[model samples]
Target chain A: MSLYIKYPKYLTAGESCVVVEFADEIDRGANDAVMNLKKYLLTQKDISIVECLPTYRSLAVYFDPTVVSADEVINAAKSAPELDGEECASSFTEISIPVCYGGEYGPDIANVAEHAGISEEDVIKRHSSKSCHCYMIGFMPGFAYLGGMDESIATPRLTNPRTVINGGSVGIAGKQTGIYPIDSPGGWQLIGRTPLRLFTPEASRPTLIEAGYEVRFVPVAEEEYKKIEAEVAAGTYKPLITEAK
Target chain B: MELIIRKAGMLTSVQDLGRWGYQSSGVPVAGAMDLPALRIGNVMLGNPEGAAALEVTLLGPEIEVKGTGAAVFAGADLGFSVNGKAVGSWRSVVLKDGDVITFKGPRGKGCRGNLCFAGGVYIPPVMNSCSTYIRAKIGGVEGRALKIGDVIKIGEPAALWKKLEGFCLPEDLDPAQDANAPLAIITGLQEDAFTEEGKKLLFESEYTITAESDRMGCRLEGAKIEHTEKGADIVSDAIPLGAVQIPGHGMPIIMLADRQTTGGYTKIGVLTPLSMEALVQKMPGSKVRFRRADVSEGVAEQMRIKEAVRRAKELRLSHVSRTHSEAPKPLFGHFILTVEGKRYEITCEEI
Candidate 1:
């Protein structure tokens, strides 16, 4: 068992905002500290905290300094309750997203496969096998930073980011994988595309997934992918859901 | 009860106090950049503080009133004419059906125009705010800028025959040349990250708002600010209102009403609330200078302003009650009244 150590470092983010750093660098443990603290602080019913946005290694706490002072926040953080060990042990959920790899759906899949010295089939199988954790949300609305990937599949970011990565396009960069919720600029190495509507403004919950959700990928034929896209456009596509423990 | 934009200006959109409480989902707090002026305009019309108003940039479009109405225009003098006849600003004026309202080029640069109808502008509130957010493509009228052929409905006036004389801002109280006004700032969390020289330069230098500025942030171009040492690629953290974040390049970016919830950068200072509202209204290329103020002074000033606003509201209420029963016939009773010791004169018409 890895013993939890309080990562040292605190920096003022803005005039009133404070960031409590959990580690000197990014890692799954650091990510856990942020998530755990976020969950803990959010449960404080009376605290007028504005927001708690978690990142790879820290949870940025925003509050109305007028209502609650920065010193109070620091005190609360130092004595924050310990996280339940079981919560961390809950394996990332198994979510299968049907992806059309290669060709128009995934123009960069073959390139990624070649770069990893693996066959196209091996890339798809390795990618779909393990569930990934939703570390945080940023860069764009509903765009999740997911962790957990077979080390063999890791690759460097592109020299030049694409001017536009369509919504629902799944890509990998370094040790991370993510899905584009909206069409925006990106630099991730695209390996495949999902037909899921990751973000839909008309939906009650616009973002298809949230931080802490698990994700899985499943290979599909191009024709099936096109059909799914059509359903999404028609507002008839329903994400395959599994009850999480 | 309705108005149509016969001619769309450079940019016209519906706004309110702001879309608060929804920053977590990455929603921008889009609202009138000139909030004080917006509030005063609403108060003049006896409308609620959160009433939707129209914010016209630089030049206002020609508007055709479709129904009987009266409205108050506030903020910078956007050159105004009714049927080609020049009129005074900061006062209520009756509009006849088919009356043409046009705003020529602004009298001066860095001026925005606000039109508050006797009745609030009727637009569906998205996420509890009428403010327009162009980026997220949500809120306001279809979550977009006002365009030609858009028919804006108006609600019933809160008070008929109400005069708008005393509530308008007197000429002198208006910031003399608001656009170029030096913004007073309070040092922020990352001020210590920069070298003493960099810190000195921040207050001494003049920065120009770049054309790239928007509701998200106002990017400044000036001497590059440098830190005492190289900084690490920081994990994202919460950002506060008016926080000035300087990334690696040294260009200071002042966050505005629609800024993101979190960011990663070395912050140098934060604009005081009073100055932030004024600075955000400035157009691109407007000159900017920063001055330092301590946090205690900043907080005290905010409290003073808040008390002043409260007093203004109470005085307006008292004036309303005083005029309602014991009455007057001055075509309008226009006099600045004192609230919380700050004075605000108003004009009221009792039929």
Candidate 2:
């Protein structure tokens, strides 16, 4: 692992926000930089930062222009503690998501396997092999942008996207993989379905997984998936959040 | 104070400033599109600028007042009437328990109107706001539009400045009114992604707001801005207020209050706050142009509006003091005054 030493660009977004762009391309280190800046920025009380949006490669710091100046916010963002490769790998609540792949759950699993020149079983194995880092949660509520997809299973998105993809559907787009927290029209190649509710609007914490967390998929049988779904609907299903050792 | 919905119009929902501070999890700032109008409506009634109000679309709601209170109809005049008698817009008026508020006749200059009460609309704040994000099913009146027979509870006005009826905001100060000048834009966010001709067309050509335009975004039909080989897609990033995103189709879509947290399109520019106010008022099929502007212009306009709202509140307070013959309430504040990097704590107390 190498230390993140690249300087960031401060792009002004209208009069209300300033985007601290760490990288133009999606870089893991840049995403970490964004998360670190956001984590540090929230602790400061001097700047009247109304809100913050941490993306894959940038962090948009929102504030009321009537109260704080862009220059001041830029200064505050600049002062965020820089991290080395080791410190950047800070402790994260590793969220283990149980997924049921193939058949009705993942309609495009076969398509993805054919496109990648691999078997459907190999596709699932590769997808669940590594722990994908959650870069940012966006699009729909609780939709997580999970990076670190295995290049062997990398596939392009479906040309004709479905009108409505079910919530908790895991999919892949180009080199990136993500979860559709809610039902939405999407182009990503469907691979699996998770029973856990990513977005519980009525719950105290609206979103289950957040940015800067890690998500690992554990393949479950159809019966187990059905059992978990019932438990979730009953409000008795607790997501397995284990410490990453 | 309480209100009952006699007839819920096309689209009427409770809205405050916005659901602020939460965007990372994909929550949008769903509030009144005509924010200035909403703010002024609240201000005229001696309510805080961000107090919850009923944002009515072209066709306004018919409400049966069940409790006596003060209310003001601001923004696009939706032909507000009480007991079938027409009333003026932008003025604070007393609402009796029996008063029936209705929207009759043709629509006004703007698309939306804000019906504000002296005391804010008393709805539980979801994520610290009453603004309704219908798509997310969060915030305001059960996170949905007010339907027939829905009860609306009103909160008590701030003790410092209670509702003072008869305070009318001058037409000149109304933010719902459009400016003669073109919309101002802080240009060139992803300037490289667009050709020079594309950039010029953005400032020169007239854009017609399409029918698809709503709170989430205003889709525009205009000159096709040429995209570079890089195409329109970029790593998804935060969608700023008034972000002019030119997609692969070469047309521009201006992101608004209910836009998603982040987007992948190339944003060529961000519209100034004043431009946003003016743009929201323009009905579908109306034309709009953009002019180059800097941050200072926006800041100046914001300060101007803030000062006006502050003065209006003070003026109404003065009138209340004169009528009641009461001493002003106690006020206290603590401020950190920084001069040339040197910090100083400043405190002021009204004794």
* CAPRI grade, predicted model 1: acceptable
- Per-residue C-alpha lDDT of model 2 across residues A6-66, encoded as one tens digit per residue: 4488888888899998887888888988988998999999899999899999999999899
| Model 2 whole-model lDDT (C-alpha atoms) | 0.84
Please give the range of 10 consecutive residues that has the lowest summed lDDT in model 2 chain B.
B323-332
Q: Residue A64 in candidate 2 has what lDDT?
A: 88
* lDDT score, candidate 1, position B97: 86
Steric collisions counted per model = 7, 0
Candidate 1, residue B20: CA error in Å? Answer: 3.6
TM-score of each: 0.83, 0.89
lDDT of candidate 2 at residue A3, scale 0 to 100: 37
Error of 2 at B153 (Å): 2.4
Per-residue lDDT over B1-351 for candidate 2, one digit per residue giving the tens place of the 0 to 100 score = 899998999999999999877788788888988887888788777688999999988888889988778888987777888899877587777788889999884364777778998788998888888999998788998888899999999988644333356667866677753544688888757878998888889889988889999988999999999988888999999998899998999988999889998999999879887789888877788888888888888788788778767866666666544433285544434468899999997644342
